[model samples]
Target chain A: MKNIDILVDNATCLRGDNLIFDNISFNLSNGEILFIMGPNGCGKTTLIRSLCGIQHLENGCIKINNVNINNPECNFLENLVYIGHNDSLSENLTTYENLEYLNKFDLSNKDEFISNPNKFLKFFDISKYKNYLVSELSQGNKKKVALSRLLFTNKKIWVLDEPLSFLDEDSKNNLIKLFLDHITNGGLIVTSTHIDFSNYFEKSKYLNMKGININE
Target chain B: MNISKIANLKYFYKHTKNVSKILSFITFSLFIVGIFWGLYIAPKDYLQGDSYRIIYVHVPAAWLSLQVYIVMAVTGFIALVWKIKIMEIISIQSASIGAYFTLIALVTGMIWGKPTWGTYWVWDARLTSELILLFLYIGIIVIYSSFTDKRQGAKIAALLAIVGLINIPIIHYSVEWWNTLHQGPTVTKFEKPSAHITMLMPLLYMLLVFNLYFVTVLIKRVRLGIFQREKNTKWMENYLND
Candidate 1:
């Protein structure tokens, strides 16, 4: 696998006349995890969105592998896997169907989940709900279906927001293991959460949005 | 020019504020003149008489209904291709305005048809295609509103708008394509208009009025959309304070 490097330089975001965050900067390479910690409404989601090229920055730019995301020639999205606060799944579609639709965006041959979705669904403990409509599933199960995309997608970078909120303890543990395994294979993950992950990954980097501080 | 520069909501909001006022003034003036000329000053139609004055309203509305859909389709294309937020907002905002124009065209056509054709309704090619156009607009509006994620809704709606564009040419050429109770051509023809100069003049004037009126209303609606979508942005706060 090739190296993955992300650069967020002097980022600033504003809401109305309010300054959400200012002069934030960070860098990450393959196998490193970026944990954005913040209180509610502290611009954690905004920062995550900006990094994923879903939101524009007022002053700075985010680059993946030295190419600025705003550049039209940049094919950043092809290598990106994003799961926002919303699961972004169709409620009317079954769990398996939703995964099938999302997998079409995966350019690489990551068909292990596509061929046998039960592998990832069982890992998340949602295999029984595979044929059920997404609307019938609980919030955690919906989230699990969304998270299962990570296992099937060959994209190197995963940007997630509040991914642990609706998951139970066992699901969360399973997800953390998946995260660890992904980084071990040179994949990079950027996540926003209020929970402390020090107990899970001691080497994980932290960016606290409350004070625009970076703790390496 | 960079598309992002032109599509900037802050600049567009302010620019439309100054421009819409002038457009509104011109629209009001033209409506008054067109009404007087078509209803009173213009010589009566030798064949149909004053009942034909409804043409002043019907023709302009019918022309604008198609024009607005074209605008919606173009904006939808830009939104889908370039993914400009302003274009998405413009595409969705045009739906209701275009729908209203289509409804006006249909109702006024019915009122005109009662005296001319001896019936208020027919499933003629021109009329049927127009009704379909209105349904397309309604479909876009409903599909857009159904999604909780507004961006996703806009994308799906944009795709529908582009696909629905095929109906425009069908609507435009329907009269030529099929035999129908609808009249063939008027001021839109390539040759000289069949009507006399005085009678034709007001119809043209009313067409201009409708065009300007669409822009006037579109500017207002798009400005409102920008405000609603950017309600929490710094530019909006600055704009509100000013």
Candidate 2:
């Protein structure tokens, strides 16, 4: 297993004039999962964004595999797979085209991605809707299509915000199975969700954003 | 000053010290002086008479139209190369101001042309190139707004700005390269300016005023960009409170 260490230390954040969270810290490694839990306005999404490098922290540092997140040379993004609250899929493009765009344009390891996306679509059980435009897909199917990206990407760290939000119980269980499969293969995951699934994983850690001090 | 520090969005947001006010003051003062000098003090053209006074506004507008694009292209290059968010903001914000300058130049040129070239519009090379530049600015703005994700839009627009830089030299040399109704260079030549000292002085002063105006507007717009992009950060919150 390739060594993957993720550390967030003394992290502080605010949204506009409101304190989101302060002095929060955590660490995780290969084959491990970190579940960030909090109430609706407790900065769970903000922390997830910071972990993905989409949002800046007010203080302290985040390091992945010993490389600081702020460092230009840090290759953390190359090893990351993120699915935010928004699917990040183009609405005008069909499901196939969206995945094709990711393969052709977005991913760093373009050649490594399977040239045919049918396998990923099949894995997500959305193969029948491959040609349907993202705008045409229902919310649950849209979430499934977004989840399909994880199958094709060989990223080590998966950061998902509310991965189970719109899914049925069956799809949720399927996703948890997929997460377990990923972890067993020495992958790291940091996900934020309202539901707690710590009992399903062996090396899972939990951080409740609501428990953190909110600096005024 | 460290280049990285300047590019740092938070550093720029806090340390910029609101210099747009000072720049606006300088721009206002210089504009007043330049307009007075050009309209009243400068000697009338032997050929065109008082009508040539339009050069004061027309020349500066034209020059700044081109100059603003250069600034956009340079900043775009920096943003793309270094992935600096502030530079991206500057590159995107510069498009509207640059477009306005291009429009002003084109409109004023047509007004001046009615008396000088006997028509309000023509297929002249310089004029066509300047019109194309305006289209390029519009293209950047439209492409940027089309994307729902602002960062992605900024990146794509930055690329377009860099590519459109080829039009700059074409516009600069169009008069010399092709037969056109428009007059050739006056203030930009390598040798001493062709126009008399009195005529050249106010034109140069007006050029400075236009440049100062660009900086003032650009600074304000960039600050606004910072606020919008960084609205969720603590420093931004504190800055807003202050």
Candidate 3:
């Protein structure tokens, strides 16, 4: 275990004049799997964004490995992986080129990621579309390519917002299998999704969100 | 005290008060003084007569137009690298201000040239390069505004801004590089200014005033951008209350 931990203390968030959530607290450390479940408009997306350092909370503090999220000296992002609602891939670039762009992030064994990646592409069954521009790819194909990046980076904490959105059943099964192995190897996965994980994986912890003071 | 407040739009407004107030006061006062001094006090050009008075507006626009482009590029770079929301917002707003100033510079230069150069428009290097700068600004605006994803738009715009920076040096050195209708450098250089001191002094003040004006405008634009972006947040609604 690499001792990965996230502490969200008294975390309150507001969306416009609407109070999305308030006084929400949670802690997850080392090899933990947390599935944030909520209906639409329940602030699941907002909470995930705040955890990934993209969205700002109104009156709260988040600490990563005991370092305050606001601390300039914090090394949290270096060890974290975040996939938001937006696909960060460029449409003008081919799927391979988009993947190549992510190679700029400093990571060990990146030399092995050179050129077309055969393993992850084959896993997602999108090996045929590697050379196609992301704009040309179907929505499902584009989503798969974006999801493959999670398997590419070796970060400790993965904060994914709607990781299952647009993935086909077979690809979803493959991903769940990969995530199972990842958690077994001491990685932390925090994701928000409406998909039920009860049939496939029973070991996953569920954190239900119902907005501010609406305990589920 | 919160270092991270500068990143998020909602929190950014909370911290905008002090800096915005001070800059607005300074820039407005200087604008009044600089305009008065340039128009009434400065002596007329011996050769061009009172027509050179247009330099008060033309020169400041020329300087700021180019400088604002550079600032836009800088903000774009920060937005791309650090993923700051304010930087992205500033990059978009700066592009328009830069374009506005470039328009003023071009129009004023043509007015000044009509009496002096025998033609209002020419194929001179400085003028052509400045026209290209206008195109670059338009290119940035079009690329950024057209995209469905604002962040994606910002990323592409930033790259373009950085690439467009190569033109700045060309625009500055075009007079020296080619035999152009535009006059060679009169103010910028290690050598003392060739123009009369009284004339140079007001022009200098106008340059300072123009830069301060850019900042004042930037601060106001940034505040508006922050508000609109955070429209979904309760804090923004409460913020409007006070």
Evaluate model 2 with DockQ and give the value: 0.09
Model 2 over residues B136-242: C-alpha lDDT tens digits? Answer: 99999999999876777888899999888976676557644663334344313223336899899899889888888999899888988888877876777887898
What lDDT is reached at residue B108 by model 1? Answer: 92
Q: For model 1 chain A, where is the 10-residue window of minimal lDDT?
A: A11-20
| CA lDDT of each prediction against the hidden true structure | 0.83, 0.83, 0.79
DockQ of 1: 0.13
User: Which residue ranges in model 2 land beyond 4 Å of their true spot?
Assistant: A10-24, A39-61, A69-186, A212-216, B1-29, B79-93, B141-159, B170-194, B216-242
TM-score of chain A of each: 0.95, 0.92, 0.92
**Residues A60-128, model 1: lDDT tens digits:** 778888999999899888878899999989999999999888887775555666677787778888889
The deviation in Å at residue B19 for candidate 1 is: 4.0
Q: Report the lDDT of model 3 for residue A208.
A: 80
- Indicate the residue-level lDDT of B32 in model 1: 89
Query: RMSD, each candidate, Å?
Result: 5.9, 6.8, 7.4
Name the TM-score of candidate 2: 0.67
lDDT of 3 by residue, A14-96 (tens): 55335787787888877778888878988898899899777667677899989987788987888887878777789999988
Candidate number with the higher lDDT (1 or 3): 1
Q: In model 3, which regions exceed 4 Å deviation? A: A1-25, A40-192, A199-203, A212-216, B1-44, B70-92, B147-167, B170-194, B208-212, B215-223, B226-242
Which is the winner by TM-score between candidate 2 and candidate 3? 2
Question: Where is model 2 chain B poorest over a 10-residue stretch in terms of lDDT?
Answer: B184-193
